[model samples]
Structure formats: structure tokens, C-alpha cells
Target chain A: MEKEQQKRAIEALLFLSEEPVKTDKVAAALSTTSVEAEKMIEELQEELSAQGRGLQIFEAAGGYQMGTRPDLSSFLEKAFSEEVSSNLSTAALEVLAIVAYKQPVTRIEIESIRGVRSQHVLDNLLKRKLIKISGRKEGPGRPLLYVTTADFLKYFGLKDLGELPELEVENEGAE
Target chain B: MVEQAEYKIKLPTFEGPFDLLFHLIKKAEVDIWQVSIADITEQYLAYLQSMKELNLEIASEFLVMAATLLRLKSKLLLPRSPKFQEQDEEEELFEINTAEELFQRLEEYRAFKKAALHLRQKEEEQKKVFLRSTGGQKIMVFTQQESVYTIWEGAHHLSEIMQRFAKIAAQREYVPAFSAVEDFVIARKADYIYAVLRQKRRSVPMKDFVIESSLWEVIITFIALLEMSRQRKVNLLQDRPFEPILVSLIEKQPELFQPEEGESGERTAKESY
Candidate 1:
């Protein structure tokens, strides 16, 4: 396929996907290698930006999705009031931060840090599709471990976990 | 209470004790090391008092923090001897360590709150952008017709199967021991219920209308109540579904539907009506 045609095809896949579109899935569909698909995606991102369209092609959760640029979000919020509004409580925010930072962590570990039971907050996060039960830890009781979803990264406007503010390691050690 | 009388200041909305502590620390703008323990402790206690006055249910975690602050404040008040024993030094060190740990936790929590604030800002920006639900489809209104049709079809098939099963079960020859008795029957159950309602002369819940007996008695009593409702002998006052049915005898008709009494008042059983 021509590069222009390939960009349109990749855009279709990302637009239709409710969740983030994986690189492998994109590569397989385009009949190209994963590296080529990634390069095409990066080029497409540049192309989308160059066009100065309201939408931006952003990568999140180890994949890519076409989302609105953060700057233009205000107009979109006015256009789609219900869908755009989201206000998380402090408890939920703290629990989400804990999950975002210390991912693949169990409920017990989160509780130990927060100094309180977080079962309710975890449930709220799961309902909102922010955090998900990644898998069960290998031990007694086999407690479910949680990790932040692509929605979480998108909501926080982060490209990935790396975008999270650098926590000072030296300050922790100073104690 | 004394703290409540000293400071009439009302704090802003705080998520938890750490958040309040962070606010106090920021408002004072003092270094943690130089921060006056006495002043902070008083302010913390006043906030707690205000929370109590508002009838807010404070969590135990907040109380734990308050206790720690009080301990630190009291340690600051005590005089230090020039000649310190090992145990005295260790105890003083422990108090200092506790205070330091509390400050460290507060600092860590503040960093996360700052990150949270950043995320909040990002969220506000992102809120202005809305993604299309489908492939470039600006509108996506979900319809329930398909799901509704399937549910009705499923219910219709389930009812048909149940009717067929009932016919098959009815035709079977198996009979239980209780089928032979005829005294405690459905027809007589209505009269018995009528007599009880007339005797009591008050509204009674359907479940209570039929005293605890066998499964057969419960079923008969339900049918009897339904029959009485049909005849207008009693009013089945049910305000809502899934709620108890209140059965009260209609006024001015004191005549009971008296049926033949069994020998032991424990009438012999009959097959279900």
C-alpha cells in the first residue's frame, strides 16, 4: 500500500478501537513488520500534527490511539458535557497514584502504604476503568494484583508510566 | 475543648489529616525542622475539634496522627537534664525519630498530591477533546431493541418448557403419604383464614396471616388470601411489590365462613389444589 493509504488504514484501526491498538495488531493488519508499522505510526503522528487537525495521534499503554489535543479539550468539553466531565475524589486519586507508581501490586501492599483499607477505592477505580486486575500474585490466597489501564494514562495525559513525575530516591534514603 | 476555645479559625476542606498538615505547613511557610510543634499541635487539635463539632465521623487514621502530634508536643515541653542516662537519651531519640518519620510521610504525601494536581490539570485540558465512538462516526446512539427481542424470545420459550414439564409431572403416578388426608384442604383454608381475621379484627401481614406450619399450609393460606381478595371479604393492602401483603377484614361483615371442624382441629391433609 502507498504510505498515504497506509496512514489512513492505521487511522481507521486506532479510531475504531475502544482500547489502545497494539503495534503487533497494526503490523499484522498492514502486512508489514512491527518495526515498519511503528515507523509508519510515528510518521502518521507527524503528518497528523503537520495538518494542524484538532485531533492528535498519541501513544499510550504501549500502543497508539487518536485523541483530541489537550489544548482543544475545553471546546470538546463544552460540546460533549457528560462524556468529558470526570472528577476523582482524593482517596481515589491517592489509590490511583499508588497503583500507577507501584503497579502489579496487590491490595495488601496498597493498604499497608495508605494505612487504611482500600478495597472500596480499588473497586471504584475498576468501575471507572482506570485500574484493572492484571493477575493474581503467586502465593497463599493468590491475591489479585492491579495495574493502571491505558485509560488511566490517557486521563492523566501521560505518554506512558515514564511521564510520571520523577520521585526522589535520595530523599527516601535520607531518612 | 480547650483548643476549640483558643482558636476560632475554620480550616479549608481537607481530604485527610496529612492534607490538613500539608496545608498548615504551607500556610505557615516554615521549615519542617524549625516548625513550632506547640503551634502545629494546637492547630491540629482545633481542626479535630471543629470536625467533631460538625458531627463528621473522623477516621481512626486521623486520631493516630493526632496522638503522634500530642506526644511530640509534650516531649518538646519536657526539660532535658545535662547528665543524660543511656535510657533517657534513647527515649528522647525515639521521640525525635517518630517526629521525623511523621514529617517524612507528610512530605511524600505532598509530592503525590502535587502530581495529582498536575494530572488534574491534564484532565481538565483533555476534557475539551472528545473522541468518536466508532470509525469517524460523530454520533453513536445505542439501541436496546435487539437485546429486548432476545429477552422476550427467551422468556416465551422458558414458559413453554415449564408448561410441558408441569403436564408431564402431573401425569406421573407417584403419590406422597399426605395426599390421602382430606380435612386440611384449600377450600376450608379460606374459611379458617376468615374466622382468624374476624377474631383478631386487625390488619395482619400475609406472611404472619398463615402461622408456621407445613409447606402445604403456607401455600393454602396464600391461595385463601387471594380468594378472599377476589370476593372482597378482605382488602389486600400492598403498597409495593416485594413488600408484605396486609390483610384486613372489610368493615360491617362480621359473619365468618365457618366450615366443618376436624376432630383434633388438626385437619387431615389433602393434595394441593
Candidate 2:
């Protein structure tokens, strides 16, 4: 298909999908290679933001999602004025940061760092689906290893685990 | 010196020992590596005192940290004689260099705490974006703001759901006495009657099959006798209403197992009668 037609189709598919659309899906739909599809996505992203369109594409959780321009949230207040504030508590946030940075880490590691009993917070995070049991550690008692989920990325507005905010620490190689 | 500790600090909330310690270190306005152990320990104990005054129960982890701080304070205050300095404490806390290790821990916690703050700001920014949805038939944005909200909302009813499932599991243990009607098969009973008659070369009383005295088996045996009689493969005779019935083969049919009309499965007791 033509480049313009493919971009329009990609936009339509993204707009139609409730979940983030993968580049492979776009490739399959347009009968194009993944590389070409990704290029088109990038070009389309640039075009939308350059024109300051109402919709902007975000690369998140290993897929592309089209969302309203973050700057225009105030204008769209009428539609979603009653949106609940789902911010987590500081304690919960701290635990999540630990799990995010040291993923597949056990509860003991997080608790030792926080110098608190974090079992309740870990349970709450599990209940919230922010973190999940990745597997059991191969240590004594085989404690469950916790890792952040895709929903965690969306929750924190992170594109991927690599996008987690920088921690200015010199002992990166310690653990 | 412990009794001289003052209660000037008012901590709003401390998640745990490290949080309180971090706050004290921050209040002192000193770097983690440069923290004055003597001053911080005094302030920490004072806060614990305030927590007690407010009737706020200090967690055991806080007490452990408090104990650790005091031990470190004494180590710092003690004169560094070569013999005393070389021998590590009996507990060997933090591999003998408690002060340096504690600083490293504080530094790690501070990094994570800053990351948490960064995430919080990201959360605020993320909320404003409002991923564009098509007002999908009956889309309600309030419930879908965060994917985690749906999970928590679903979790809210989890107790009620698990309670219902537990009831179902308890009920599953009860085997309803007569409602379990699938075990007996008429065709299999008819085959047994055929085998008995063939072996005896004479009529076999139906009471032989109904020896168990179970109502289900007796009912099924009677039905099987009637069905065999209808097919003309056996003759069923009863002297009276309550008398035991006799079942006998009329003609020798070779291999009666396979249904002549290609009917595959044995009729369950619940199917016909």
C-alpha cells in the first residue's frame, strides 16, 4: 500500500484498539516488514506532535498507544472530571521502586533495605497488580521473587523497565 | 545522657526504622557519609520517646535499629585502644564497620526514596494524558483511569467470591444419595442375566442379581428384565406381585455384547425408566 494509506490505516487501528498495538501487528495488517512499520510509526508520531494534534502516540510496555495530548488534559476535564485519584501511598511507592530497580528480588531484600516489615505493602502491591510473583528463588525456603508488571510501566508512565528514573548511586555494582 | 534526650522533633509519619533515620539525617542537614553518629542517635531516641508519648507503638524493627544506633554510638565514644579496636564485637554487626555500612544503607534508601518521588511525579503527569478512548458504547472513564484500579475494584469483591466458592467446595463433598443415578447400566445387567442362564442352562431368579438389596440395583434389575423380555432374548416370569422374578434365555444368540442395531453405549438407569 501507499505510505500515506499505511499511516492512516495504522492510526485507525491504534485508535480502534483498546490496548496498545504492537509493531508486528501493524506490520501484519499493512503486509509490510516490521522495520518499515516501525519507521512509519515513528514518522507518524513526529507528524502528529509536530502539528500539535489532539492525539499523540506513546511507546510504552513494548507497544505503541495513541493517547490524548497530555498538555490538553485540562480542556478535556468535562469528560473525565470525576476520575478517581489512584495515587499510591509513599510506602507503597518506595516498595515499588525497590522492586522495579532490583527486579526478581525477594521480599527479604526489600524489607532489609526499607528497614521495615513490607509484607503488607507487598501484598497490597500484588493486589493492585503492580508487581507479581515471577518465580521462586533458589535459596533457603525458596522465597517468591517479585518483579514489576506491564501495568506497572503504564502506572508509572514508563516506556519500559530501562526508562525507570535514574538513581544517583556509586555502588551500582555492589549487588 | 539517654535521659537527657529532648523531644523537640514531631515526626508526621515514619514507614519504618529507615524512614525515621532518613528523616533525622535530613533534619541534621548533613550528607549520609558525613552524618554525626552521636547527634543522630540522640535525635532518633528522642523521636522514639515522642512516639511513645503519642501512644504510637514503635515496631520491633525500630527498636532493633535503636539498639544498633546505641551500640555504634558507644563504639565511636570508646577510646580506640589497639586491643579493643582490633577485636570485632561478639555479634560482628555489619562486618565490624557498622558506621560505613550504615551510611551505605542510608545512601541506598535515599536513592530509592528519590526514585519513588520521581515515580510519583510521573504518576501525576500520566494521569493528565488520559489515553483517548472512543466513548466505547458505554465507556466510563472514572473506573478506567488506572489499570490497577480495575484490579483493586475486582479484588474488593474477592472475599465474597472466595466465600461462595468455599460453600461450593463444602457442598461438593456431599454425595446426594439417589440423585447419583449414573453408575448402573441396563445393557450390562442384561448381559449378566444372559451369562447366568447360559451357564446354568436353566432360568435364573432375578433375586440373584438383586442380592445387594439396594433400591437402585433392584429397580435397575427389574427394568433390565423387562427390556430383555421386550427384545425376545429372555423370558421373565413372576409367580406373584411380590415374588422374586425368573429370567431365562429364549434362544442362544452368539456374542450379545455388540448391539444388533449398532447402538453403541449401554443405556444408563436414568435414561429409560
Candidate 3:
């Protein structure tokens, strides 16, 4: 298939997909290698950006998604006017940070670090689909371990956990 | 000196006691290692007093820290003898470097707080970039088991399916008791089960297989299923403990565990009587 046709096909697929679309799926659809498909995606992203389109192709959580430009949110909200606000409190933010960094960590661990009970804060995060009970740590009482979800990455505009800022060695060594 | 300690500071934005400690350390502009524990403890207590005066809803954790700081302050004031050994406290306390441990915890929290601020910025930026709402688009149905957006949603879906199944199962009227044992036709009942399995070409639950009235008939059908399983005509799968036992055909094995033609003929003849 021609590059133009492939780009259009990729664009259509991304627009239609409700979830992130993987490169392999795009490659299979285009009858091209995954590497070739990745190049196509990059080219498509450049084309879209060059065009100054309202939608931007964002790579996150092991796949790609087409979303509105990040800075255009206020204008989009005014245009669409849906009551959507994800304002999280400071306590919630702190708990989320601990979970994001020390994922598969237990509630007790988060509590110990915060020097306060974070049970309700964890419940709120769980309700919001920001964090999930990944599994239970193997030990006495088998406390549930928490991990951030893909929604967490999306909410934070992070491509993955690696996108988080590097922690100082002195800070990390204190643990 | 402890009673004389008064902090004019009014902290409006500390998330918790540790956060307050972090602020105090930072505001003092002294290296945490070099700061005097007695002065820090006094200031911390004074802040706690201010919180009490302002009628703030102080959490128990704050009070606990107050007790800890008081203990550390008392320990700091004590005269150390040359032969003094570090004795364990009366309560269940971890290692006793109270001041040092508090400092370390405050540092750790500050690092995460910085990370949180970075994430907060990202979140603000991402909030502007919105996806097209999942409207007017054909929803992709996920039949094959894969991780969906949220496991909770998957679990909730499973529970709804389970409830529907239970409702259907409950709707199945109880089989009326038989008039006599001779009313049970074992050969025909077994054949019916085998035919159903063949028609479905998939695992059929044991509960769905035995919708008969008589106990003897159900027993005979169960025995027949066991015999078929033994002969490799059908495979029994119990996916989990307490789940329904599922019966499936061995696809490669075309021949069923047939009681010899004459034997089934004779059993049918006897069943007719």
C-alpha cells in the first residue's frame, strides 16, 4: 500500500479505537513490519502536528492514542461543556505518588511513609480507577499490594512509569 | 525552656504531620543533620499548640508525633554516663534513633512530594488533551479474556453474568418426584445426555445435564457419564473448586463408549417393561 493510504488507514484506526492501539496491530492491518508501522506512526504524528490539527497522537502505556492538544483543554471544555473535572486533593496526590513510585507496595508501607493513615485515600484512588489492588504481598496477614493503572498514566500524561522524574540517590538510599 | 517555646507561624497547607516537619526543616534553612533536635521539637510542639488553639481537627497521628518528639526531647536533655548502654524502651518501638529516623522520613516524603508536583503538572497538561468521547462509535466487544481498562469492571461484569445464570437456574422448576423406580429409563436418559453433548460440541455443565425427576434416573445418567469419561469419549473439567463440573467430548475420538448393540437392545427392551 502507498504511504499516504497507510497513514490514512492508521489515522482512521486510531480515531475509531476506544483504547490504545498497538503497533503490531497496525502493522498487521497495513501488511508491514512493526518497525515500518512505527515509522509510519511517527510520520503521521509529524503530519498531524504540521497541519496544526486539534488532535495529537500521543504514545503512552505501550501504545498510541489520538487525543486533543493538551493546552486546548479549556477551550474544548467551553466548546463541549461537559462537567468533567478530575481535581484531586493533596492527600490523594501524595498517596498516588507513593503508589506510583513504590508500586506493588502495601497500605502499611504508604502509611508508614506518610506518618498517617491513608486507607480512605487509597479507597478514593481505587474508586477513581487511578490505582488498583495488583496482588497481595506474601507474609503475615497477606496485605494487599497497590499499583497504578493505565488510567493513572493517562491522567498524568505519562508515557509510562519511566516518565516519572528521577529520584535523588540520597532520598532513595534513605529507604 | 520548653514552656517558653512559641511559634508565630500559622501553617495553612501542610497535608500531615510529616509534611509540617518537612516545612519546618526547610524553613529553618539549616542542614537537617546539623539542626538541634531540642529546638525543632519545641517548635513542633508549639505548632501543635497553635493547631489546638485554632480548633483544627488534628488527627491522632499528629498527637502520636507530639508524644514521640517529647520523648526525643527528654532523651536529649538526659546526662549520658560513660558506661550507658542503649536500652530498649517499654513499648513496642522499632530502632530508637528517634530524631534521626524522623529526619529520614521527612526527607523521603519531600522527595515523593517533588515527584507529585511533577506529576501534578503533567496531569494539568493531559487534562487539556481529551480523547473523542466513546459515542457514535461501534464499541469493540471483548469476548476473549484479556485485561480490560479496569479489573473491577471485569469482575462486575462477571458478577452480573453469574446473577443472570442463577436467575435462569432458579427459573428451572424442580423436577417432580417419580411414581416408581421402574419409571426411570437409564439407557434412554444416557443417550439423551450424549446427544446433547454432541449437539453443543462444547462443555456442558453437570447441573444442566441432570434435569430429571427420579433420583434413580439421575444416578444412572451420572454413572453413564463416568463410564463415557473412563472410555475417553468425554472429558470432565472442573476449572475451579466448587465450580460446576463441565463435560466435553474428546474431538479426535469419534467412537463413543457404546454398551454393545445387543446389550443396549436388551436394556432398552427391559426399560420398556
Candidate 4:
């Protein structure tokens, strides 16, 4: 396929997909390798940026998805009459930060970090589908492990877990 | 007792002694920049005395705030040279700003609390309208009680089981203790789902997958399943009202189920690798 045609196809795939579309899947569909698909995607991203559209492509959860530009979210919210806004309570935001920094983490670990029971805050985040039960911890009582969902990545505009800013250890070797 | 009840009724939720001081400052409309510490301290102690009379629970937070106010008041009373007035002004201004910030936060919190009450009323009205509309349909709606923690707990249990099984498989001697019912599918995609379903069958719920495996194994299997899902080799389904999700093998993906006689050998090789 022509480069322009391939770019359109990738755009269509991302738009139609309910979940993040992996680069390899896009490559296989276009009969190209992942490296080629990635290059094409990079070119397409530049093209989209040059056009100055409200939508931008984002890499998240090891895949790509079409996301609303941060600057345009307020306009979109007004246009769609979106009732559910992402205004988190201070406690909920704190818990979310803890979970994001230390994921595949158990509730006990989170609570220990915050010095309080995080059950209510965890419940609220799960209801919003921003965080999910990724799995369980293996110990005396199997504690459920929590991880940020793709929605979380998309909402926060993060490429992947690797994109999280490296935590500055206050005192690494003091112990 | 009657007088104490009346007194308690007038006081808002006792946040702390700082909150009480802030409340008095706001009511007095005193410029925080020029706050008379002696007057504020006297009012704060009076409030504490009143709280004691009301028999309300007085936490250490309240007592600590009292001590802090007293210390600040004494600092303000200290005689200093005219040259040091600038330093004192800066320090006093900072103290006032801190108190002002706390007061603003409390005011914002109160506004939110009031808004929450209004929201509750709106929710009640909506619920009434919903019930009125649904009067004809005998639909049974069940609210799912499960939370993320519950789901995580289930996954945790499954990973533990997978870990135990992996350990047994590694020992070689303990491998015979496990039952072998289905033929091992060798194709990479088929093996991924088969391994998961096998683990699921043993645990009954997919949460068992997490319990049965080591952290590393659970993570690998999860990534493998995710990759397979991306490839459309398997289907993952979940229902509303929080039922345990069912992952089924999609038969259309024939490449996934293809068996290899050398599968066990390949598994051993993979383990070694």
C-alpha cells in the first residue's frame, strides 16, 4: 500500500478499535513489519500534528489509540455535555498516585504507604474504571494486586508504565 | 446538661484548635496581617474551656494547637529593636498567611459539604422519577457488590496456585502427583490459552490463575494472554453486575489449537532457556 494509504488504514484501525491497537497487529494487517509500521505511525503522527486537529494519537499500554488533545478536552466536554468529569477527591488522588507509582501492588501495601485504610478510595477508582484488579499477591492471605488500566494511561496521557517519571529516592543507601 | 447541649449545638465540628482560632479571627474580621495574638490566644483558650464544659472529646490535635498559639503569642510580646521590626513583620505576616490559608481551605470544604447535600437531594429526585418510569417492567436489577480489591484478591489466589504448580513441575519428582487429562497443545497461541484454562479449571475462577503461579510466571502468562487477545486467538468476556469474567477459546483461530508431539520437549527447552 502507498504510505498515505497505509497511514489512513492505521488511523481507521485505531479509531474503530475499542481497545488500544498493538503496533504488530497494525503491521500484520498492512502486510508490513512492526518497525515499518512504527515509522509510518511516526510520520502519520507528524501529519496529524501539522493539520492541527482536535484528535491526536497516543501510545499507551503497549499500543496506540486516538486521544483528545488536552487543550481541546474542555471544548469537547462542552460539546458532548459530559456529566462525568474527572475531578478526584484529594484522598482519591493521593491513593491513585500511590497506586500508579507502585502497581501490581496490594491494598495492604497501599494502605501502609498512606497510613490509612484505602478501601473506599479504591472502590471509587474501580467504579470509574481507571484502576483494575490486575491480579493477586501470593502470601498468607492472597491480597489483590491493583494496576492502572489503559483508560488510566489514556487519561493521564502516558505512553506506558515506563513513561512514568523516575521516582527520586530520598535516601537510597541510608538503611 | 441542657446548657451544655445548647453550647455544643452552636459549635461546628471541632476540626482542631487552629480551626477554632481561624473561626474567631474571621468572625472578628481582624486583618490577619495585624492580628492581635493576645486577643486571639485568649479567645482560643476560652473556646477550649467551653469545649471542656460541653464534655466533647478533645483530641491531642486541639491541645497541640492551643500550645502553638500560646507560643506564637509570647513571641509577639517579646521586646525588640526598631531595626528588627522588619524581621518581626515578615514572621508575623507569614503566620497570618498560614492561618488565612487554613481558613480558606475550611471555607471551601464547607461549600463542598453544602453542595453534597444538594446533590443528595437531586439524586433522590432522580431515583423517584426512575422508579415511576420503571413501574410497568418487572425487571430485577441487582447491584454488583464486588470491588477492585475483591477481584484482585481472586487473582492473587490464582497466581499462588500457579506458583505452587510451577514449583512442583520444576521438581520433576512431584510432577506425577498432578493429573493429566487433555493432550498438551504445542502451538504458541493454543498453549497460552490452554495453560490458562487448565489453571482456571483447577481453581474454578480465573482468579486462581494468579494464585497458582509465581509473580514472574503470572506476569508472563498475563502478557501472553494479552498478546493472544491482541492476535484474536482467544476471547475475553465480562458481564455487567460484576460476574466473574469467562475467557473462552475461539475455535475459528485453528492455528491456536494445533498440537505438536514435541510440545513437552519444547516446554522443557523453554524452561531451560
DockQ each: 0.28, 0.45, 0.48, 0.02
Name the runs in model 4 displaced over 4 angstroms. A134-138, A172-175, B1-273
| Residues B241-272, model 3: lDDT tens digits | 34677888776532443444225524654766
Each prediction's TM-score versus the true structure: 0.60, 0.65, 0.66, 0.41
Error of 4 at B175 (Å): 53
Q: Residue B261 in candidate 3 has what lDDT? A: 28
Error of 3 at A77 (Å): 2.1
Off by over 4 Å in 3: A169-175, B1-11, B81-85, B90-96, B140-273
Q: Residue B240 CA error for candidate 1 (Å)? A: 30
Q: Pick the candidate with the highest TM-score.
A: 3
Residue pairs clashing in model 1 are A73-B128, A73-B129, A74-B128, A77-B128, B181-B269
> Which run of 10 residues does model 2 chain B get worst, by summed lDDT?
B140-149
In candidate 2, what are the lDDT values of residues A74-144, reduced to their tens digit?
A: 88877677764568999999999999999899998898788887999999999999999999999799999
Top candidate by lDDT? 2
Interface RMSD of 1: 4.2
List model 1 lDDT by residue over B1-273, tens digit each. Answer: 545546555556766667777788888898655567788888888778887876668877678768778877766677745466224434321133356666666666666666666667766665655665643233332332221223344455568866875675578664452453434565577667767787899998878756665444665677767766766677887553345778898764435433433221233333332
Model 2 DockQ, alpha carbons vs. true complex: 0.45
Q: In candidate 2, which residue pairs get closer than 3 Å at backbone N, Cα or C atoms, i.e. clash? A: none
Return the TM-score for candidate 3, rounded to 2 decimals: 0.66
Each candidate structure's count of clashing pairs: 5, 0, 0, 24
CA-lDDT, candidates in order: 0.70, 0.78, 0.75, 0.58
